[model samples]
Target: MQQLALFIRKEFIHVLRDRRTLLILFGMPVMQILIFGFALSNEVKNARLVVVDHGRDLATAALIARLDASRYFEVEQVALSPPALEATFRRGEVKVAVVFPARFYEQWQHGRDVAVQVIADASDPNTATTLTQYVSAIVYDHATEQREAQALPYGLRVETRMLYNPQLEGAPNYVPGVMALVLMLVCVMMTAVSIVREKETGTLEVLLVSPFRPVLVIVAKAVPYLILSLVNVGTILVLSTTVLHVPVQGNVLLLLAESILFITTCLALGIFISVQTSSQQVAMLISLMGMLLPTILFSGFMFPIENMPVPLQVIAHAVPAKWYYIIVKAIMIKGLGIAAVWKETLVLAGMTAGWLFISVKRFNIRLA
Candidate 1:
């Protein structure tokens, strides 16, 4: 009991001595909550929109005015032709384009139905779907108000078309983000601490004296955990598919391969962290502070990148999890193959290589 108490005291001393680790452990959670709460909300506002009022009547103008007055939308451009509308959407400046059909007001006057066409960018299915709903609600509200005041029989209908995720099930969106967060947490944190433990307990030097090559030593340490992570990957797959109802619409083998790649990338980052920090506390701090928060914020898990401040949006590109989330969504939701995800896969490969090259170089320098 005395020995155990002494060991606990020693651990406290060690933890207290490391200021960086202490700060990260205490500060990271607070920072993450604040960042995610304020900056990462899914609710969108001031979304860039285009309007084509073909009817040019009072009712159409009033509808447009109502939409423009709302804080959720921003009228960026007005297009008169279909080709021009397509060009505006393709340029990526506008998220949704609203078109009022000809005789929009006359139909309302004659007790006929009015149709408004809403075209949304399918690339970001969540925002696109949400915007389409917003357009409908606003139009409906405007018509209801007019009907109540004027006692008219006019009906207004909204036609919605979503480009990418036609069905806005949120699971597909979260599955990829979950993959990123889990891999980063499990791979980097565990591997980093294990490696540092060997060094702290003087087992690493003993391993160096043994017959095994240092690279082999590193491999032997990583291999078992890599296999374990595969089991975790399988569990996540089952959970996501059977329990969560987010099924893999793409090749199962391809999805497995991508998971392996992402796991390897995370392991490489762990190895890099292992090389940088001598203590388990520092390694844990790096994993939590450097990996976790960014994974949630930048991966577009909670916040739409379009709605974030420009600086934060730029910083998101630096997060590898951001790319992996996109890959996961493409494979799981869109069912896209390598042809579609090659760019993201390439980016992951590059990031993995960078981490490996740096870790190996640092390890070799230490040996020399």
Candidate 2:
């Protein structure tokens, strides 16, 4: 116990003594959270809109007012003709173009289906879809109000209630993903680099020759990292809730427990990577390629896994972050209990067990 305590203390001192590494260990999460929360977002805002109004009637004016009032759009340009509208779109001056044909008000007065042409830049399919939906909702609401004022019979009403995220805010979706990414990168890379650095400097040989068993040495090295990772988890959660306004609707203790489990899994994988490499560069490369890429890409952190190709979807199942992300979204967004996310929890547990077993086996073989 005394030897273990001494080794853990030494590891902590080694980590704290390095100023750059210490900065990366603590600063990276804060920076990523701020960047993702403030800078990067899927929700459309201030998208430039061009209006081509030939009617110049009350109905056209009402439509223009609605578009301007929408937070998603900024009606900055009014094209006189289709050629000018095309020129605006070609020049990338506007994302959407609305054209109100002549007799738009007359058609509405006659209770006919009024045609309002909406053209959006489909270069980005997601953004285009959102813009179209926002415009369509506004038009539908205005049409309904007009009909009701004239005692016109109601048409089909489609009521959309967005569950979990009523405002469709991006922070709730991104915060949990950022948490998974930060924890995975920090735990895996730091552990792999620390172990490989020791091996490169010949100090690992001295530790191997000491009375401490090989497993005990590995565990002692990981102890400080595990504690530090928990601190990171707390920091991320506090920032996510307070600054980002992302709420954790589930049991906070459960979320922390799951985060610890994920940290352990990443640490074991890092040990495995360290055992496979002799140099710090190789360890860092493998950690980045093996953990970071898959965590960001295949884990459904930024993109929907269901939209991925079938082969890639199958590959994503092997990523630990994939399961962890799902578990987090379920818990934090949906307020689901353990019973709802039991399958993901079981998969993570299995992965941790498998990684630890393989890492222990490789460590023993290397010692031999």
Candidate 3:
């Protein structure tokens, strides 16, 4: 029993010495609990709602008040109409818009049929549907209250318009997210693992001693991966358009350019990881498992980022995949041009430059 206890203590001491093992054992569970607790929620609340109240009457005021008072909506009145509203939606300024027709209260008071238009940005079809449903229920309840108060039978019709994706298809929502995930995981993992493999086999050390600067050699080694990742982007795009029937609604060349920038950013990230880690296992683990959750949770594709806690929402901005996902959705789903996505594009460019700068600064020619 004493010998067995000694063996157990030795194994525990071995595990305690490995920072990586300790992190996996204790750090990951706490991280998962916090992230899953705060980030994984489907209930939408405090959604920005744009209202064009053409009626401008007492009844319309009451309805708008109710909507704003509801926990699900935060209303902002705007003087926007159909064709002009497209720009607002493209900018992601509002999730849903309520357009009260002119003389809305008068028509309802006279017992005439009145229609209220609810225009939703359906880039994320599920949210769009849920928001529309909320609006419809509110409208119905308002109509019922009005009728009971005045002792008159009149109704308010909700004409829902789901823009971008009229059919409420899932493909339009998930394809861009999948594109971001695929590019991030594939590029980061491949670049990190390939370079780390060279280091494990002693090839990287041999090349490090060569005449060329170590940074330049690292760039040379990673360039092929950048090309291959671009090819993967093209293949994914083709499959998305043909097999999935999610068309590229914006400039194809521009999309390709954006994809190249994102792939470069991911490659830079992978290079930074390879420089920091000596083992292929560590590189792969960091590239795959470390990046996977951030890309999914923060990317704003699976869950609405605005609904999360303020800190998590702030953290979402740091995830490169979030910017890429936003860019792809703007270009592909909304048919937006560079003007709409320039900020996100600049962010990705800055991230790429930052990663390259960090990787070059940290790379040491001396082998550890």
Per-prediction backbone clash count: 2, 0, 0
lDDT-wise, the better of 1 and 3 is 3
Q: After superposition, how far is residue 131 of candidate 3 from its true place, in Å?
A: 14
1 against 3, candidate with superior TM-score: 3
How do all the candidates rank in terms of TM-score, highest first? 2, 3, 1
lDDT of each residue in 1-368, candidate 3, tens digit only: 45344533544464457686446434443343334323544457799999998999988899999999988899999887677788899999889999999998889889887899999989999789999988988988888878889888534444567899885556677778777887787778767876787788897687778665676666665666566567666766776677667899999888899999998999899999998998988998999898899998999888899999999999999999999999999999999999999999999999999999998999887888
lDDT of each: 0.76, 0.87, 0.81
Candidate 1 lDDT tens digits, 1-368: 45344533544465457675445333433343334334554667899878888888888888888899988899753646888778877888789989998899888877676789999999999889899988988888887777778787544545566655565445566666766777777778867886788788887787667655656555555655566567666766776677557678888898889888888888889989998888999999998799989988888886788899999999998788898888888888778899999999998999989998888777743332
Candidate number with the higher TM-score (1 or 2) = 2
Candidate with the larger lDDT of 2 and 3: 2
The per-prediction CA RMSD against the true structure, in angstroms, equals: 11.8, 1.8, 15.5
Give the better candidate number (2 or 3) by TM-score: 2
Report residue 46 deviation for candidate 3 (angstroms): 32
Residue 284 alpha-carbon offset, candidate 2, angstroms: 0.4
| Model 2 steric clash pairs | none
Residues 1-368, candidate 2: write the lDDT tens digits.
99999999999999999998888789999999888987888789998888888888999998899889988889864646777777777888788888889999998898888789899999889899999888898898888788889987666877788999998888988888888898889899999999889888878888877788888888987899999999998998899999999889999999988988889988988888888888999999999878888988999978889999999999999988988898899888899889888898888889888877887777742433
Cα displacement (angstroms), candidate 1, residue 81, comes to 46
